[model samples]
Target: MPSLTLEQANQIIAGALARSKASGFKPMGVAVLDDAGHLKAFAREDGASMFRFEVAQGKAWGAVGMGASSRALMQRAKDNPNFFVSLAATSGGRFLPQTGAVLIKDAAGQVLGAVGASGGTGDEDEAICIAGVESAGLSAG
Candidate 1:
């Protein structure tokens, strides 16, 4: 089983920030988490709110815990609001069923970790996450 390395995590965050800047998005926060849902790397762009870090980490943590993209979790939340709400509590508010996060997978489709972004619109944030994963030579799921 391939695991996410600190180098890769750093690359992901760098790529995400670059993309966000090139796209003219607002100041952003990005987070990378290992498969165990541990923070591997994180960054918050200048001018971003202090809360952006928590929001980014929460999205990635939820993706890692659920073994799915945060976008998917958002859909699930729509279908089961109560359960999803409970899950947020169960995770001590570390879970966020929203867009802007994706599972990081190897070539063999093995999940290595997750990456998440905040401060932009959901679509913009998610796009940067996918871009970051690809920039790191990994797949986004």
Candidate 2:
């Protein structure tokens, strides 16, 4: 299975930041994770809050772990709030059901990793994530 390279991760983060800046969003924090849900790269804009890092990481972690976009996870949580909340606790608060992240898929639709962002509305965050994935020439799902 092919994995996202460090160069690719860096590109994604750079693109995300650029998009966020262009949209006039508040300073953002972005995170990229490998297929195994391990951190590949992370960046917090100079003015981004400290909490952005963890929120960004959790969104990416949830995407990689569930093999779906964080949007999907959010819908699932709405249908099963108890289980979803418990899942967050079970993952020790490392899982978040929100729409600021997406699974990274290769051309063959293989899961490569995930990208996530914080410091904007969930929609804005998700938009940046999708932009990053596309900028990296990967699919976001």
Q: After superposition, how far is residue 138 of candidate 1 from its true place, in Å?
A: 0.4
Residue-level lDDT of model 1, residues 1-141, one tens digit each, is: 679999999999999998999999999999999999999999999999778989999999999999999999999999999999999999899999899999999999999999999999989999999999999999999
With a 3 Å backbone cut-off (N, CA, C), the pairs that clash in candidate 1 are: none
**Model 1: ten consecutive residues of lowest lDDT:** 44-53
lDDT of 2: 0.94
What overall lDDT, based on C-alpha atoms, would model 1 receive against the true structure? 0.95
What does candidate 2's lDDT look like per residue over 7-56, in tens digits? 99998999899899999999999999999999999999998987998999
Model 2: weakest 10-residue lDDT segment is 46-55
Superposition TM-score, candidate 2 onto the true structure: 0.98
The residue-level lDDT of candidate 1 at 10 comes to 96
Q: List where candidate 2 sits over 4 angstroms from the true fold.
A: none
TM-scores for every predicted model: 0.98, 0.98
